[model samples]
Target: MRTLIIIPAYNEEGSIAQVIGDIREHAPEVDIVVVNDGSKDRTEAIARDAGAEVITMPFNVGIGGGMQTGYLYAYQNGYDAAVQMDADGQHRAADLPKLLAAIPYSDLVIGSRYVEQTAYRSSATRRVGILFFSKLVSFVTRQRFTDTTSGFRAANRKVIALYANYYPSDYPEVESIVYLKRRGCRLAEVPVEMRSREAGRSSITPLKSVYYMLKVTLSVLMSASRVRVRGVKTSG
Candidate 1:
């Protein structure tokens, strides 16, 4: 498959080059595109220097908007599949093949940290939120998700087109799974090891994490209600 790795970056000048280099070293065959989400830093310049195609947003549109731009690029360029990875170096490039291998079985494949158990750890509050969302998503979609917030994922052309047309704007990862399920897209998860951020602090603080959980839960519930009422299955 013609796969494109989409890295959404915002003020990631510290780690963007290393992330791009790792992807190039590990997955040379696949194309790479870095969506610079209106970074005040030199993220776009560094990404360009790293030899990956760069798309600079005029303003910060958050992760979802940046990823949607990548999907649109993939769709317009006729890519058969696309994989999303972080620019902070948390996601491993070596795991790209595992995600791609699973693409033949499903429309979307998520790289999950809890699938086989590794050394991934988060705060207790965050863990509780993840557990709550996991069960809630399973209940709504009838598909269990071990890690709903994981940004490491691969998608087929159908999913690419869907996301290109419409995607959540903020805190989109968990809600996106539910959206795909509602649209009748097949989803699966594979075990992958995630490393700690090599540079920069996470944007999610304790207060933001609380808000994230509440907002995502509400968004998922609202989307599920609409799907049930419409009784419509979205097509590629």
Candidate 2:
């Protein structure tokens, strides 16, 4: 299948090259699309130099918008599947094939941190927060989501159409799980080892994390209650 690895980059200059090169090394035939989300740094140029097809947004559109643009490009370009990965070095490229292999059986394939180990070495509060989000998403979608915030996922044609059509304005990882569930999309997970960022600080501050959870909760509720009007115009 023709797969496109869509990396949404925003001020990720330090890791973009390594990320792209790693993907090329493991999956050289897989196409890459670097959505340079208005990086104030040299992320776009570095990604381009790394041999990825770059799409520069005039401004930072956030991860949701950037990923939707990837879906648009993938659909228009006739890609069979698409994987959404982070520009940060946290996600490993080696685990990409595991997700790809499972995409055939499901519309979405998630990289779960809680699939086997629960006590991951991170901030105590952060782990609790992740578990909270996980339960909330599971309750909403009737599907267990161990890692609701993992961006390392693979999507098929159905999911591409779904996202290209009702993605959220802000954080989309959890909301997307609900979105796909509403559309009868199958979801699966595989263990993908992740690492701590070696470069810039994380954007998930305590306040931001709280705000993100609330926003996602609201989005999930809104998604669950909304009537799926057939053939209605949607922008995800």
Report every candidate's CA lDDT: 0.90, 0.85
Q: By lDDT, who's the top model here?
A: 1
Candidate 2: residue 188 Cα off by (Å): 0.8
Q: List the residue pairs that clash in candidate 2.
A: 165-236, 166-236, 167-236
lDDT of 2 by residue, 45-134 (tens): 899999999999999888889989999998889899999999987788898889999988998999987797633457788778788888
Compared with the true structure, what per-residue lDDT tens digits does model 1 show for residues 49-109? 9999999999999988999999999999999999999998999999998899999999999
How many times do residue backbones clash in model 1? 0
Residue pairs in collision within model 1: none
Candidate 2, which segments miss by more than 4 Å at Cα? 118-120, 228-236
Whose TM-score is greatest here?
1
